[model samples]
Target: MTERETTYEAPQGEGRDRQPAGQASPAERSVGDSVFHRHERAVDEVPDQPAVIAPGEKYQLSSAGRRWRIGEIFKLLRKYEVWNDITPVRLRCLLEELGPIFVKMGQILANRSEILPQRFCDELRKLRTDVDPVPYTIVRDCLHAEYRRPLSEVFSWIDEEPLGSASLAQVHRARLVTGEDVAVKVQRPGAQQVMAQDIDIMRSIVRLASHFVQTDQFVDLHDVVEELWESFREETNFIMEARNLDDFYEFHLGTKGISCPRPYMKLCTEHVVVMDYVDGVSISDPDALIDAGYSLKQLGSRIVEDYSTQVLDDGFFHADPHAGNIIVKDGVVYFIDLGMVGRMSNHDRLIVKDIIYSVAEGDVPKLKDSLLRFAVSRGDSGALDHAAFLSDLDYIVADFAGLDLKDLDIGEFLTSLVNLARKNDVELPSVVTMFARGMVTLEGLLSEYMPHVNMIQIIRSHIANEKSTYKRLEDGARELSVESLRAARGTLEAAEHIGLATRMLTRGQLKVNTQIMGSEEVLRHVGGIVDRMSMSIVIAGLFIGSSVVYYAKIEPVIFGIPVIGFLGYASALILALGLGREIWRNGHARK
Candidate 1:
């Protein structure tokens, strides 16, 4: 659901290259990132570090997962070796050659222009996920393998050419014997195996990179990659995707202004899927949509409501709602590629609804408590600085606070809140992050359709309508009564305990007991300090010892330096720097 600029004029596009800071690009205006980039300079000739793979020692690099043999590596490298210069385009080409996993990574990077250099993002955007379709004969073999019959028995006329080709599969237009036009998705031969091997290669890279990088934070590199792998696994399962499509299609069958394609469960298998053929227009193309005589405002309103209902009301949402995954068909928005979806329990949906209501009401303390409820806390959560949290929330909500009700943006507020949550010891599910990002993409998608629609007003209207629903009224009353009874029972128990304590004090029958307990918090702090000190001393000793060894001019010298001594010195240098930084942070905190 991450946003990527499709064309030059869309809200989130290459306008960063031309727009000044005062007159920001539509993307930066919509969302702010501190490290955002501008591809203002000519970039085709800009030099970049070529990604090289030197086959290292077997024990460290050549594990069971890394099946990249020496010959295969060299062959892949040679394809891009034009005068030994590996340009960004060549890098993208190499990723394509490597496999679909790498291409998926490239597509992800193409959207992170803020984190990555603009030149790299531009070239990686050209990394094609859609490749040449597998031969028709091979496709026929796959279909036959799935059905154990000749293709002629099912399809009256299957086009020799694929209608669309993607990383894992290709779609072919066909007519079933029943005279129904259908799209058949055939998995590429050995696509699963290739992706598995690529994931192995990625794991090795992450392992090596973590040693030299500070990768510990709210997100872990390995976990992130594994999550991506899980997503890919879901997408590769055609049967699961067919089920998802069916669920969505059924959910919105009678809904106006939007729909999902129908899936044929009978024709689905692990490798192939049959669904209704939708010859649709890219939602990114505004002129065509306008020429079709569809009101952009009406379409945009429907799109926003569809997603809000999925997330806030239904709690079952399309996790990836980027422009490419959506299409315009006969004045209705048709959603495709239902491999990845997000679902929340009724309780989670209630918490999210409360959060939105809190924001709308400008109740910062209530919002903080509602958000903190989802966060995991130890003994010190009550000790959380309420003032600090309130300040942060106020800053986050400033855009919408005291605004003309018609101009507020609930999506931006949600995105900001999610990003702010991670740094403050607030633990949230990945699906929440995905939902927030999907909202951001939804905004960019609808900007072309309707520039003036206020999402906050829509959210408010939805909540008001929900409050008046009979089901909600019954639920609210039941919950309130239950909570009140629990509170009263707890109060009576506390009064009884106090009466017993008073009686014991009057009779002098309560024995006084006292013991000093070491605080786990303080002990942990001291232990961390001692650990840093020990590491610092060890690193210093290593540096001094290595210096002595080097001065003695010992054996195994390389480039006029002892190899072992050089290694020790490098290790000590990194550790000493880290120690210094840690000390500085602690000292600064004390001040």
Candidate 2:
């Protein structure tokens, strides 16, 4: 089998010149010149001196100072006509210049074509965190600090050349003194601190931007930032990743055709991880895999089946299963990079199964119920229009009904479902979004290997085969029992409340307060109508009284009319004209 290629390749410069240790590579220099060089002077103006302040104070000061400096530099650039219109390339370059946190943000946005344009998403997909490898001295220092031992005590031979280098960490090939080949992943020095600081800055920026930007139309920016921090925290913790690897290894112990790296727990720490060195051909290289006597179709099917089991049955899954993260050795598929994983609760897993089953059966009502159960209401659940939500689901179901199993795109379907939920004022859990992105990525990787593989069909079949009729009936009975008990409890509570209310009413102690939305305006409008009606009644009474006075001759006559009748007639005329003028004014105001 062909050995797996290096995880990242440094961009080649003109003539492919090499750089010495502790210096920037040609690629890094070019990037800095384009983005940072222009604003170097402005950035230098900010004092970098340490101060005696509280932890929170220090963080606030640092984040605020950085934000202000960035804003100033951007303003200066714009004023000087040094910046151009932001295109896809410029945006990616800017994110790179902004640092790893922003680069991760851009990468996340790359998969979100529903929110961004296709071209932008395509361009962002090219975003890579590959930088010059950390110097060997720094790498040695990190290992010594983590292990607290001499190099000879652990590894007999360690390669200075990095297998891969990313923003968060770098991996190198090594052999243990015990004669075992292993891979050493060292977390970059100060990576955690920089990430924490950048995350704070990101939160501050998002909070400030929320005032002028409406992100409810898409995903919440605040949630996005928080999720980014959570992911960063998980990915940077090497111990956690080692634990994940152990769990995954155990889960697949007896399973065939799937494997993952086994970490050496004794050697793993927050700053470093050591695991088995996987020597295999990357699944991305189809020709090499074929040459190694592996059937592409079989590999794709096996991967899909295993992934389905990971999600639906195990409730734990490899969140990022891109081409680079997968490899093949002797017909066995290996999943590496256990740093980032997703987990779902049992309840969520069952709901997801129901969703898939409903879609397969073309049952719209069941699909709606499953989605609503899976979704979270941002506000009052009672406020949602069930009718409209059901209507939208019907349209989505109809659109999918016509597509054949092979023609169905599971990623697109899930995205549409998520978008519909968002439009109806409901939000799915973050895990669901992550799963959707993972599925899309996995599909893209398998598009060439297995064009006829239907993920939805496979999942549906898995669900069916996993549950027997007896099991299904047992589950139904359990659910029915729970719902029946809840209903009984609710009914009893209602009766007791009604009896209490009746007693209060008999004793004249019952009080009811009703609050209507927009009540102030409603009440004001009602009061105005009442005033107008009262004024009309008074004017009519005056007219009738005046006519009666004139007929009865109650006062001294003036020009064949009683004096009181004449005064009443004048008053009524003035009042009527005033009411007319007020009506006209109100009408014009409304218009």
Candidate 3:
């Protein structure tokens, strides 16, 4: 066999095992504990970070929150007369009153400009990231602890006045001793403690809301909070942020024309990042670029292309692509805030590319499967109504045409999509929402400058190129065969699982009366798999036999039909019919 063919078979032997080959017994430590340990280590390494007082805080919260029972909450709402505002204003006000966790929630909701109703999102977007900047003394002390040196020794001059202050960190302009102008980002003192408390509050909110509210038509609050926690945790790690900066800079390969602030390796710490700062006019001021002798259309088009390439091409993106994050400096777009980024594995990237391609081609079935793959986490056992998903997809895809892609309200589509999934109890990946958010933001940015640009055409071209590249890599027959074998192995494992179900049923492991319907569904699914596999085997057998016969110069007829041609066709059809009949009967009988 050729090297490619030999390499293809390398994974074939191991593919049958769902776990790694020669699986070991489960370790005493769980993955959750390992993750927690890492978090603890990171926290311990940060100097002068305040200890979290969970018990005291919990007591205070329980005592305070008890006053706002269901009746009281409703009474307050009525007294404020805020029930008439469907504009998300009332919700914003509530979040403000609830404290930092709710503020963080508002930020996350704002990021989902696509998945949220525009009016609601528009209102929530107004929730500023501004918080009380940590006292200058606290900031100085934290910096001193991080560097273990006098602040003046490194920086010739440091601005006490912050350029901007957000909930987590604040930025200040400074000059290094070597005369390099830079920006220093200092984490707020006791920030980690604040985050822990805020997270606890968020968890409590989700728990309470899930128990009391009618949000079955949207994402379950608990799961959304879990996703939010992961996002926030990832963002809070400065090491991760440093890596994000480096990774995107390397991935972009300089053609992106966007600049990342270079991290000063020696000066960086868990709570502080010193980096070269680029001065620019904010993207929010559309007129500023024009006055600076730059074409708005050119700038907007570049933003769209850069974002498309990052997502569809590189599979890593700045999850937050809002205008405030983009700065026009020396005619180049500078991407700031490296904390939040999204990364997709190659497999995920290919699947997403297929999804985008299917959407562009108006392939309803393919689009539905792609969306399911995009939404449903691996090993999810929940019932997904593929037919219903396809129906909704048909409406969206059909409507996507005719309108200028830039003008198409993706925000509206995502709201509908999220609603549909929520209604069916389908859990979508938070990263997918992040993707949608980034794309929507890019489109919104483009609209500010190049209003007439056809975004659909732009996205279509990007997807086409991505698909072409994928096809090129997958064109090798050996690679194709390997993928086929891997798929077969997966099918076989599923079959074994079905056999286990049968064994469990025989052993009375299942609750007979309560599980009758579920059992029937499982049987139908297994039977369908069996039928398809049988048909495939038979068809392959006939084709191979017929090919051998033709090669051997066999007789022209077989049972009064032309040998190898008509007989093979007839045999294949019979096999398909048998399988189809078996599948149909199994479904009917099970029901």
Which has the greatest lDDT? 2
Backbone N/Cα/C clashes per model: 0, 0, 0
For each candidate, the alpha-carbon lDDT, in order, equals 0.70, 0.77, 0.65
Residue-level lDDT of model 2, residues 524-589, one tens digit each, is 999999999999999999999999999999869988899999999999999999999999999999
lDDT of 1 by residue, 1-591 (tens): 211121111223333233221222222222212111111121223334212223452112234424444356567788778468567888888888766777877655554443446788668856667665655555655675566544556777666567877778888888887888899998775666556656766677788887777644313446557766877788788999999999889888778867877889999987788999888887777688888887777777777788878887778789777667788888789998787788877877878888877876788887888888766551236355556667888887666676776666655667568656654546567677667657766766666556766666676677678665788889889999999999999999999998998999999987779733436678889899899989978998999999998999897999999988999999999998888898899899989
TM per model? Answer: 0.65, 0.71, 0.64
Candidate rank order under TM-score: 2, 1, 3
User: What is candidate 2's local distance difference test score?
Assistant: 0.77
TM-score of 1: 0.65
Which is the leading candidate under TM-score?
2
lDDT of 3 by residue, 1-591 (tens): 453232112223333112321211111012223323444554567645633435554213333334333344466457556767544877777666444456767766765543467678778866657655544444555665565545557776666557887766888788887889889988755444445545666577667766666564234556657766787677666777877777777776567467677777677766678888888988788788789987777777677677777877788899877787889888778788888888876766777776656655778787767767776552246665566666777887787644565566654555555555555556667667777666666666666656766665666676666556657676656678998999999999999989988999999996545434326767978886886887799888887876667566566765654576667767877887877787799789979
Candidate 3: Cα lDDT at 17: 17
Structure candidate 3, residue pairs in collision: none
- Model 1: weakest 10-residue lDDT segment is 33-42
